[model samples]
Target: MRDLVAPALASLVCLAILIGLGVWQLERKAWKEALIDRIVARSRIDPPAPLPAFDAFDPARDEFERVRVHGRFLNDKETLVHGLAPGDTPGRALQGYYVITPLRLDDGRIVLVNRGFVPTELKEVARRAAGQVEGEATVTGMLRQSEVRAMFVPAPNPQTGEWFNRDVPGIAAAKGLATAGPSGVAPYLIEADQTPNPGGWPKGGQLRVDLPNNHLQYAFTWFGLALCLVGVFTAFALRRLRGETGNGETGENPASATATPPRP
Candidate 1:
């Protein structure tokens, strides 16, 4: 009984934890599915609509929405972020950098636009100067929310003008738009369309919406582990019970057996 106590308690605790993890994964699966659906539906909208007023911008409600804006590219203040370009072969990716340039809207507000991927050799502004459009331009693309940096993401180096994540606020602050009043800057970014640029160094339409849905697999793994633990605990308990029953039936008294042997 004493030996069984510790094992039983530990098994129960482990089982509960596994079940909790399984449930959590299931919930995450549902959320991911819904998010994918929303993104797909929004991406399919044809003839992109003009973006809403800057004052009405909502990251959560407007993310992934197809929008067009008339603005002038502030190419000098562009920030290049480390990125990868899709390769011709499946599952292959090419090293590159994304050109994030701020667009000065006609309404006197600024919005960051990810013009797209440029090869490592074309990373320098001078190398891709031909693609940089001067004067007024119309940008048609998808509106995206600011990306939160993950724990593993490295911090951006302001002096070097290199960034790891698409942190909109951080970029705006680093680019001297932080103090730009309420009507000064938009809180989101626009991923430019596939329209060809002049020099064609920085290719557009590089947005990849491939979100891996592995929650189902995770749920199955957790549930499977719980089932195996239950089987092991049941087997251990049954074997202990059988041993106790056999001992009682044989009337095996350890104290008497030893005392009699000592007297003889």
Candidate 2:
């Protein structure tokens, strides 16, 4: 009994921690599922709603809500976000840049639109001269929040026109974009839909709503390890307790002393 005390207590503590981690993963799974559903639902709305006032939009609640805005493209002010072409592209996937062009609204405010992916070969604006839209245009797409910079992501250099993430404010400031109305540039970005451009370059419709959800698999792994831990500890305790009991019995009934071992 004494020999099992330390291991028993330690096993109990380990069990608690393992179970806690499993529960946390389950919670994360539920959250990710809900978010994916929301994105799908919002993006499918017919005739996207008109853009609301800058102050009226809520980043926490309005992400992925499809909206339409009328504006003119500032084509020369394009910023290229380094990324890979979508797997659904016409041919083999190629390394490319997402042409993030600014749309100046009638109200004089600027909204950055992720026009879509363009291959490295057509990187120069001159190469794809036909796609550079002119005059007033209407863009219908999903609203998205800005991406956060991770530790490993390289910061954008002033000289380079490339970026790693969809950082709204950072791009706006660098491109010298602002608004005629209050709040300056819009807080969020508009991920344009797959509407064809005149010259068929800088293809539209590049929003990725679905994200990877593997929390369930991770939860199973943790729980399985915890079960193995219990089985091992149980076998150890049983063997140890049985050995101690047998030693005691043999010591009391030694062959030389018979039953007079403890009478003194």
For each candidate, give its TM-score against the true structure.
0.82, 0.86
Note each model's CA RMSD in angstroms: 4.3, 4.5
TM-score of 1: 0.82
| Model 2 Cα lDDT, one tens digit per residue, 111-183 | 8899988989998888998988899999999998778978999888747776888898889888887732355
By TM-score, the best candidate is 2
lDDT of 1 at 43: 70
Question: Where is model 2 more than 4 Å wrong at Cα?
Answer: 87-92, 179-183, 244-264
